[model samples]
Target chain A: MARNPIRDEIAIVGLGSTGFYRDSGGRSAKALACDASIRAIRDAGFEPGDIDGIVGAAEPGGPNPNEMSAALGLPQVTHFSSPMPVAVFALVDAMNAIFSGSCSTVLLYFAYTRLPWNSRSAAEDPFRRHHTLGVMPAPESVNAAAAYAAWASRYIHEYDARREDFGRVALNARAGAARNPLAVMKTPLSMEGYLQARMIREPLCLLDMDIPVDGADAFVLTRTECAREKTRNPVVVHAATTGLVGTNDEDQLPSLRRHGQHVVVESLRAKSDLWLEDMDIFFPYDGFSIITLGWIENFGWCPPGGAGRFLEEHWDPEAGCVMIDGRIPLNPHGGSLSEGATRGSGHIREAVMQLRGDAGERQVAGARNALIGCGGFFFNSQGAILRRL
Target chain B: MSEDVDDAALIERFPYVRIDHDSKHFYRGWLDERLLFNRCDACERFHHPPKPVCPSCWCASLTPTEVSGRGVIHLAMFLHQGPPAPGVDYAMAAHPVVAVELEEQEGLRFTSTVIGCPREAIRIGLPVELGWVERFGAPFPVFRPVEGS
Candidate 1:
């Protein structure tokens, strides 16, 4: 089957975020969503009533798209969907809504509270009965952190990678966060501090994982002509694709190697045509540090077994370095690990920020091109390449 | 089933592990007492929580082999919180948890509680040994540092 081109297509006219924080005061998820939506609408030269479609990124305890549509008094929303983790799937849904003529102007929004709950616990609400429980049942062995840790163990053993290599990524993120005022962890992280930090999962310290935060982000999407008229710096979506390489079953683990080899790398290489080295900036999902390592190799940035060495040699914040060759910047907005968690929406927001040139102090110089990646439940992955238009 | 024992005590001593068909294959079931893990021949890598195939090689040629129960404590943490199941208490420090990397099982790591010691004594890089607790009518491996080793 011929691949669909999501190129030079739906332009993001305006982007707004509530500036992630550990707490959202007493605001409900809907209120947070509305605040971000309002910012995005006004930024795009539109009013609340101008939006015709409502889309949400499915969060554990957040407002539904339909609920948001109703709450915002949009009269009638022609399209709605919650693509969890936001970026790619949300973009796909938004584009479909625009293309199908269901809605010309779409509001893509997401919000959540930071409750410090494990992802493996049973659903606290009745709404999640149909969806799989985020937490594992008791007396059962594995949790999400442990599952990812098991993968980290495999990566280290197979490749002889060092634990310190993972630290480098975290340190780089913290440094990036220091430059980003919106980043939650503004203090510089020393190697001594990182090494001494308590472990959350095997081979993954607390620093290695993304900190959950209560936050919301929104984006305004419209046709190219409308976007140009709406905003001064419209970031065109050059190409966007979401991939589901494996099932949620036990069989998926063994298939990860092949999936990483054939499904992820091969397909991304074909679609983007821009080598990992050619990209100017990267916002690969850092839900876990190992995931970043997995992507470094999967995206063909380096050889499969060479990610550790690449990270070790190239990750130097003091020298202003990036993972890709020739100083291609990475995660300037401190990424998920350093920035307060916007789920994966932070990646999309950062891309928009880079293109809009409003990134302020943390801006990557001459960042005309950016790449963003987001992962979902059951190993679903998505990638987007954006260019400032 | 004893009436004398309180429900908390009864549930506390009862070892439990989630053993689906997938977990059964991952932690190679051996006569309901022993557990084994498989290693992929092509990549020369050991699979933790065993698997029927090599993750790296795509080859189904995997062999189940018994690993030395001994390993280094790569990283360890005491999880104060657990799944909101019953009989869990915040007072019992040992109820938290422990994770270790097996020396023999390259890249293979497991999460288990530190038995026979206070949670405060658990430290990173402590040598630990595998111990089994019966749960759901099967023995599952967990870690405890070797005594006087």
Candidate 2:
């Protein structure tokens, strides 16, 4: 195993969210980002002057690191960067900056907004229309989002997986959302409702994909030494990693059994002193239900093509969600499906809350460890283990 | 052979595609109704969606080689709603898109919509041969069910 000196070295001291929404009610993405960042700083028991580093995910319409720092009136910032989204990239960047002493305190932020391509109302709005796809793409390509559906077809054919398997993932997310006031789609969903959902991309329907919304999540990170000195028991990053394989092309991906998710699982396992048996909560990304299944199987929660059956066996009908072996709850925060796509920021935020015992009604009793499998299977796959000490 | 086509004319031909220097040859092949993939001369392996160097051996000696455009469908999806494209009517029918695992090389695949076949027949493992259709007055590569397969 490669050395992981940084394991449990950094702690997330503060967390803030603008509470996801379908529309920001006229608030721009920059405005949402500033709102969340300010709250995060305050939650950390620090003022804007305490923040010396800024790392912002380069979300489509989100603000930059400097913009967030400036908007929040941070006095000075020694390190600032705009990493590509899905949360952990910025997390890793912030952690490295803190460890390397580029900055003592870092405010990592992510903001999302409904853009013209994804939302019709956003398209009609004059401000959002400027965010254009400079070059139109023919429908023949399976490059990005379309690849999930294309591969979901393969996943079904190869494993004889039914629509119900994907449905369960949606059902679980919806159930969690009902308890999560921050979520947008709180209406309880049944298996029948999911099966009959509108088929935007066949084999994967509207419920299979993440709901786009305007919101923001931000966090304050500092050295573990500082965190322990400030708080009685602060949650820390036990291990964090982003992974990719050589065959990253959506269509060219060798098969479901292998991809970035597998790499992430392997890397996290190597770095982490904690394992699934020690995990108190699980946050598998539900950007696409198929992606969640990929994490389930790739993380060795079950064998290949076994997530569908495993989820059924471990399903907590009372909770209306998957409670693994009647203990661990998957994505207690409603997740991207119902919680509005924070591009894994929602997952990270929820993990932080659960570890800090601040998850309100969704909190697991005495939660201590959180295993988050973030991003999709191809290029963006990431995983993290957060622990409270 | 395609050097005569200026960049402006090339972009005009494929207005929807963002063609850079590396992929110009591949898209240029589409204008001639020929599909091309970058084949590394050293290892003779094929890669798609065009990369500058061969992933296998890191050799920049690449050729935009044309294959038989014959393959089996490895991944398939239908779009009930999607981006606007010519000759596609999502309201009337679900448009099909497929990624075919080309026989020339393992895992070397090209993605396109299948035509001249019932939607039911468009599925994984379906044998297909490359075909062409016009989109915005330019050749668009497509797939069709291979005869007797």
Candidate 3:
């Protein structure tokens, strides 16, 4: 596959987010989007009228481009879209629009008005379908926690991984969250707390699930040269690729450690010149703890099923095994697991901050290159490599 | 009974269906106590959760055939707060759901609940056979552990 020269051609100049809350009572999704977008515009030193492209998850309660344009008063929106399901699709589309010269100075963000899973209205929705373990849509069961529980069960059965191993995943994220001022979860989560956490679905305790948060995160993307002139630091978008390996069959979608080829990593490598080990920070999607384990293994940080062992032996909030600095980090902003759910938008924002040396106390020291892997299911994988210029 | 009356009740019983021109037959088969799956005439491959065209061969010439209803539980979950089922209150009922890969093909997977087995007994690789049960006015296929399995 010929690599598009658009690699590293664009830069992210601004990142903004609302304070992630357990519940923003009566706050409409559009209001959250507006708050995040305006903050991003100012952070980029641009006005709403300067935004020429709009991209995000604009459905259910989110505002469409025209509505958002009217609300934010964007003078023009020549390129606009709201891709379905996966959050990474919006970011990738924004990058392509700029690459194709369709528009410049794009705004990309995500917001959600989450309803409780067991609420009368939420459970009774006819369209509430849950894809179990990435395949086999369970019409009778729309609780996503159940689907993840099944995946965790299979992972435990096949790999003999203990529950404590899963606890380590949650514990690590909480440790990272302690340093993040914007993280919704602040209290330290102990192994005992994780083990005794209420079981929403067997094998997936309450701590294992991503908390439903009401907030929005937005990013501003501009051409690399324009970004340098406008901002003191520009995080170059080295490469962003989407839809690496699709889940077409049940056998292809298991949450257990996959053997043989890791097509997602291969596709990511094909898009950029950076090797996996050179990254100063790793931000894999962590909507569920098990998904993070899969990424840790797939990213070649450790051998298959070695994530449990890796965390036990090498991973620490202050020290890590991957680099000479001893502080190699993942999810410096605490991730969706702790910082609250911005889908993968929070992951992208944090990566940019780390690269700019603007992450404050949680910042990885002297960080130059960062890799952000998005998407947690086998149905698709999206990722990008960002480097400071 | 008139077909229209029966269909109306089925629609009320299971409102979760995406019934359209292509998938109406699958629901109709369920009403007749038949669990139908689409088998592509060209590729001889079976498809679950019926689609208009075979994904592999893109052939619209497909036949709805009843499966053996025998398979092993690939994975199962015991939900403390399950999705709402007909006649069951959301707060009271906890469901044990299973994903069975049918014996007809390696990856022909379907979602159903396993009956007659304790939640503790449900585990990966447990053999199960399909059994029909009525929810509201609709008959749905559920699975149970095979005798002595």
Candidate 2 interface RMSD (Å): 0.7
Query: Which pairs clash inside model 2?
Result: none
Best candidate, TM-score-wise?
A: 2
Model 1 chain A: lowest-lDDT 10 consecutive positions = A119-128
Each model's DockQ score: 0.11, 0.91, 0.36
lDDT of 3 by residue, B59-92 (tens): 9999998898999988777666644566545356
Query: lDDT tens string, model 3, A89-123?
Result: 78888889998999988998787656535233433
Docking class of 3: acceptable
Worst 10 residues of 2 chain B by lDDT: B1-10
All candidates in order of DockQ, best leading: 2, 3, 1
TM-scores for every candidate against the unseen true structure = 0.73, 0.99, 0.90
Question: lDDT of each prediction vs. the true structure?
Answer: 0.67, 0.91, 0.74
For model 1, the stretches where C-alpha displacement exceeds 4 angstroms are A116-136, A231-233, A247-252, A260-262, A317-323, A376-378, B1-149
Error of 3 at A31 (Å): 1.8
Q: Per model, how much of the real contact set is kept?
A: 0.10, 0.94, 0.34
Better model by TM-score: candidate 2 vs candidate 3: 2
